[model samples]
Target: MIGSFVLLNCKKNREKEVMMQLKKIPEIKEIQCLTGPYDILIKVESPTIEELNETITWKIRKISDVRTTYTLKINEEATDCKDDN
Candidate 1:
């Protein structure tokens, strides 16, 4: 699966609406409202990168009051744990 993180910059007074709208999209697995440069952060997973690209570009970017978005594709895992028998 392809995993990605999206940072949303919403118009003033539109954070709640934006979050609600985003939640309806099925691929958006997790979301959070944050206090920082970005108003909301979202994690999404798809079967492939192209599918993710379409969701972000077509569905997400088309929302009203969404000022802009910065997307990062998750590429690698920093660590993994295993137990030796």
Candidate 2:
């Protein structure tokens, strides 16, 4: 499995709507609206890189209020699972 995080920059006054749309995407496991260079941070998992790309385009970018997105993928195995507890 591949794990990734996407940072979204949304159109002005559209954070809530964009977040709601994000929730409908199956690959996205979590999201939070925040104050920074991006408005929302999303966590996603997929079986392959291509499928992850498809989810980013078809589900994320397709949202009406989404202006841009920056994706970061996990490249190494975790040393700890304490955070999951």
Task: State which candidate has the highest lDDT.
Answer: 1
Listed per model in order, the count of residue pairs whose N, CA or C atoms clash below 3 Å is 0, 0
Candidate 2 on 1-85: residue-level lDDT in tens?
7889999999999999998888888899989989978999999899999999899988899887899999998797577857855
Root-mean-square deviation of every model = 2.6, 3.1
Q: lDDT tens string, model 1, 1-85?
A: 8999999999998999999999899999998998988899998899998999999998888989889999999997455567666
CA lDDT of each prediction against the hidden true structure? 0.91, 0.90
Q: Which stretches of candidate 2 lie over 4 Å from their true place?
A: 77-85
Tell me how far the alpha carbon of residue 74 in candidate 1 is from the true structure, in angstroms, after superposition: 0.4
